[model samples]
Target: MTRRILENSKVLITGGAGFIGSNLTETLLNQNNQVTVLDNFSTGKMENLLPFFSRKNFRLIVGDIRDLDRCREAVQGQEYVLHEAALGSVPRSVKDPMTTTAVNVLGFVNMLYAAQKAGVKRFVYAASSSTYGDSVSLPKVEEQIGRPLSPYAITKYTNELYAENFHALYGIDTVGLRYFNVFGRRQDPDGVYAAVIPKFVKSLLEHKSPTINGDGSFSRDFTYVENVVLANQLALLAEAPEAVNQVYNIASGERMTLNELFFCLRDNLAAFDLEIGKVNPVYGPVRAGDIPHSQACIEKAKARLGYAPVFDVRSGLREATKWYFENL
Candidate 1:
């Protein structure tokens, strides 16, 4: 992939104190860009952004995207916007659909309008694999998406719609990234809504048996956080007009079953502590609003934005396990 210098460019990253957002902030700052983070700390942790507080180019605006005034203020004078702030999780959305819609859908539109008004050069936001709801396809393509299975899926799909409309009507360039099961370092593992990888890693490290929600048949295309960061960079810097105003699946183009994921984590964590290998996973009922399988056809992203994922699931798991072992 061609590396574009974003040095000295003013960039705003919503949810910068969260998992993916913090990683993006680190990457952009390494490239010498001026980075500003807008986060509510409702779900985002301040520890993620604390490392950058002393950086001359890093600024933090403690606020929520649900607030339009905060969104407007965050986008002002920013050349690029990476909108990653949203209440994520199927169960959480199911429990509180009203709050989810207000934050994900309403907040997204506010950001779009704010970016438009501020004349931001490019607006890239987090879309989701959940939007591929109920489609029993092996490899999910960008054009074909099924009806949203949950409130979270609907909100993400709505963001795509609003983004496309913003690009067409306001002439603002936009790219939506439909991320698969993204996992990596610093992913929170304490919460009930924690992602599988981090949550399982935490359990295994504690020598506790992590429960699989199904019979271990469920699967997902687990993309690494660095790969997601690469896709964001490509979305922001891609010179092709066709790449803009489009959504791309950011993934490793591979899938892993929960059973396989379990063993992979077990074996990797066991390398650090032999006792962890003996802890077998407990099986449970399948989760509501969960599809049987999910995989992404990333050719659209490759052809359009030159996105090539550097780490596959196994490679990413190896790195992630090492980080969790060290940090947790």
Candidate 2:
């Protein structure tokens, strides 16, 4: 935590108008770093980029990563690239695999090629927990992986492979953070592919019951956005040779069942509106392509990238609830 932070330099964040990318944009802007955002506004929101519009250090290109020219334009003179653009959602991929692969896999190579050709110092991208697909390991480690259960998982694993190839062949420094179930502010809760936490919080705020996609026994290692922002910053500046061209599990190193997550969100929301306490979760059949449980062994990130997540599950839920109470 004591190393230098990214500042006074140029940075490009693809999908910078999305939840995690916007947070990263905000943090770097505060440091006075010149930040450029390239987004197609497909899944990313214009509202997330609204706060940064007036900042002098902020630049936005209304473009898609699937476009090689746009990717090249976004990476020009950039010292680092944070690739966060993708169509995320297992069920969504199940329904439509073609669009997902086009964006996640094809779009990823476009960005990486652009960054490599630009001679960017570091290429830090958002990898996924879904890459550890079908593996029954309690706490997921980087080395072990199983067959992908969904197209979304396949796309993410493809990202890791491409990143490795780019580093070995082209010598562009790269780091992939296999993010867990990340949740926090500015996350859109209205979409069909919305994350569970924000969607559940929105439902409770509206005094409606949220549906848990399974029997509520399935668990995940939910990470806060701030921790992810920190990880990206560290990965961008990490000088360790072992850290580059590698993927690390970025999480709180904790796990909570869906039933537990429901109650936690309920309890936190009830603090503002007492009626939220009465809202319960309705049970549904297990979701397709979802693992039974997931947790992260974060020792690799801790040792290599100096990653230490400051927000645990309840605390992150508390902050997220507060934001939802005020905004939604």
Candidate 3:
């Protein structure tokens, strides 16, 4: 017999066509769980989920999570709700704070309210590593969150707050996973707001110079997408009542600098006999609302949710690089 989460669950994932959401959809469907994905296609693409378009257990809704009726409809009869829809990018958010706030905060509240009213078994959301904003801590723990630096970071922190309030007032089981720099397949490499890994990998593959946003000393805990999936699975399945209404750091529990990541990507591309272009990264001033360093402890997730991230940066990058080579 399969686990309850696998056997009888109908999961709803907002933004299910984006990089992390699409990967999570693939994982859940593989686990024998029914998955309903609601995406607006603003950043999410149908190509990201083209492989699963024919699966009976998978359903797709082309809608925005910001809409109350859509949110309510998506939450109806769902066992677990994984809210991943949001405008993500510090620089982009800094440029247009209103759009970020509307999507990340207002959309989050709409989803939470809808899920709570629908009586979903658990509500888990994608928080960000940016929540540890100005804290100069080396390895960030869940309990010690600093002031948010960017509009995006503030919105993520706001998600945690809304989740906690919903859990407390409405008896909704909510867990927030503060994800670090998640990277892997299906990540958009063309957008100006694309993440670091995909952007660098795409640039390197295209024989272009990858731009470093700041001095190379800035570091991050670049978590893989698989670890995030595992964290969400645990958040949905964990039976401990104490785990409700809390936040957990979802990461690989390691750290690497941007310069280090650049070289690593270069080397991986080189392995394919793809002549690595000159590693001349154009330097720019540090962008606003960006933290200098970030690393997650992940002990809370380990002890509470049994979240064991299987892949570190190197293993994850190898797989990601292979995917980029094959797909891009």
lDDT of 2 by residue, 20-123 (tens): 99999999999999999999999999999998899999999999888999999989999989999999999999999999999999999999999999999999
Quantify all predictions' global Cα lDDT against the true fold.
0.93, 0.93, 0.88
Candidate 3 per-residue lDDT over residues 167-226, each given as its tens digit: 778899889999999999999998778889989988888888888989889989999898
> In candidate 1, which residue ranges exceed 4 Å CA deviation?
none
RMSD of 1: 0.9
Tell me the lDDT of model 1 at 233. 90
Count of clashes in candidate 1: 0
**lDDT against true structure, model 1:** 0.93
Report the error of model 2 at residue 122, Å.
0.6
Q: What's the residue-level lDDT of 141 in candidate 3?
A: 88
Model 3 lowest lDDT segment of ten = 1-10
Candidate 2 structure lDDT: 0.93
Query: Which of the two candidates, 2 or 3, achieves a greater TM-score against the reference?
Result: 2
